[model samples]
Target: MGILEKIGDIEREIARTQKNKATEHHLGLLKAKLAKFRAELLEPKSAGGAKGEGFDVMKSGDARVVMIGFPSVGKSTLLNKVTKTQSEAGAYEFTTLTCIPGKIDYNGAEIQLLDLPGIIEGAAQGKGRGRQVIAVARTADLILMMLDATKSRKQRTLLEAELEAVGLRINTRKPNIYFKIKKGGGISYNKTCNLTHLNERLVAQILQSYKIFNAEILIREDCTVDQFIDVVLGNRKYVKCLYCYNKVDEISLEEVDRLAHEPNTVVVSCEQNLNLDYLIEQIWYHLNLLRVYTKKRGEFPDFSDGLIMRNGATVEHVCHSIHRSLVENFKYALVWGTSTKHDPQRVGLAHTVDTEDVVQIVSK
Candidate 1:
């Protein structure tokens, strides 16, 4: 049978198989096999494996945020409202046939917003050029999953399922599992905590299914078989996803309130221009970006221009952001911000910087 057919068969087998101690190893092995087939299915059709045209937009700005949802979900409307770039907006399906990029300046930082074509059901299965859409989504620092407030709840569910099927774990972290292959020694399995879902024998079975005869496995926490499969495949992306429910004006206040209360969710009406400012705020918040200002030895710091950096950025990062060769002659940095114990404190390259901090590089 073909790869898709094999995947379907394994999925069916896994679904029918009962979950219990008796069939745990079997289930784990089946999951590993399923993961392998899916990985192979995603392999490039050509040998070179280059990206197709129209999806090759250069990444710009301090951070990137991509909008993904069903057709006519107001992605284009939202993009046009926030940024000067005018994406084609319509009330019909598949209005956007390609990825359109726009830049929005917020808090003195330029953020790149992408309006991707609306994806359909079975997107992950290569339907409606979804592989291209998902390919672009993987490059995003954040995912803006737009949903129609008037549509059924399944819209969000289906969109999430497509993203998940392509190995995008939204609002989650990678599993803490250490695995290494060895040449001579046998399997060395160890764990710090009690694993309820996985045991030594099950791990061995799963490894053997992948032809991993001799390897070292360390389980840091109790994780599922699918998580283990993710570790083995090692191509999964863990990104922050904000669920944006648009067309809130078409829904009741109670329904809108319900969606607003959900974790990492925002309610907005693009047509009514409601809650767009708050949406931008949440975008910056989720990005966790910091702005650092630079000062000269005898001059005032330029308040209008600031260097954008991620949270936990060190003085060394600041130096690199200034220039590639700046670090060579770097003596030290005088930091004036909350990250330092005292204002204008002398710090080494290892010192971390806070938002809106004034940094002066003292060179030799």
Candidate 2:
């Protein structure tokens, strides 16, 4: 009768049920219920327990990336090797009892790298400080899933499951499903393209399970029931995860090569100080950051200190980042970069900025 029990039962049912067109609706409803129960399980108790200690580190830098894996997987070692901050690196399990923060400055951007405590199997169920670790993981811009190259591949699978159970969709994009809850109209289901996984009936059943009687549903792409569940919950973190396999020195070259070839995977040996630079480069790439240099009217642009901005940032964003009051002055920006057809082209607040662009804001 508990939320966990309900979630387990639904999961078992979903696993045992044969996948067919006949059972699609049943499966959809079951997944919706499972998501509901999981959400409830994660809700705070009425007793209002004190939060875990050392997990409240203030977020700094342009982006945050958290190291997550089982203990003794070289998370701390990697953190210590990459960043100036020294996290305790040990050969024993649970060496890191709390969240440890470090900083990495690469390509004019400051990245906050956190070495989180090891995550256990039942992390979603709040086992072994799993809840606290996962709570911090959700806040990260990227997840550095550190694994042991010497260990079996099961570690990666289990870690993925634990994070997946908690609504962390790694290296994945959000489902292209347009869903809106209407006040009075009945379900208006439409699809732009052919959807093989979901139909109007199954969609209606899934929506009704969440007590959504009136809604507008537009299926833009072919997505599964679980993805639809994620859309309905609307709290899932679709983050980019880089699978970092440490201790590659202990593994065979063939094994190391295989891991390195895997998508979004990096193989490194923190103890041997190998491939750490490339790992940092990959982190910068996946973070999707941009550096824009600012110029005064007469003086040259300070290329030494470029303004770090996110990808797809605009002139307005640049103004706000420089100073909140800059936008209030109503100015135009002179952009000199690949983004402009001519050198130092004048643009408005809506103009998107590119990496290494020289921006000079002219106020009215």
TM-score of 2: 0.96
Off by over 4 Å in 2: 44-54
Per-residue CA lDDT of model 2 for 1-364, tens digit only, reads 7777888899899999999988877888888888888887887556677755638889999999999999999999888888898888788899999898999989988899999999889999999999889989999999999998889999999999999989999989999999899999899999999887788888888888889999988888999989988998899999999999989999888988888999999999999999999999999989999999999999999999999998999999999889988998956889999999999798999999999999999998
Alpha-carbon RMSD, candidate 1: 1.7
* Residue ranges of candidate 1 with Cα displaced over 4 Å: 45-54
Q: In candidate 2, which residue pairs clash? A: none
- How does model 2 fare in lDDT? 0.90
lDDT of 1 by residue, 213-321 (tens): 8988899998999998888778999999999999999989999999999999999999999999999999999988989999999999999999999999999999999
User: How many clashes in candidate 2?
Assistant: 0
Candidate 2 minimal-lDDT segment of 10 residues: 45-54
Best by TM-score: 2
Judge candidate 1 at residue 137 and give its lDDT.
Answer: 94
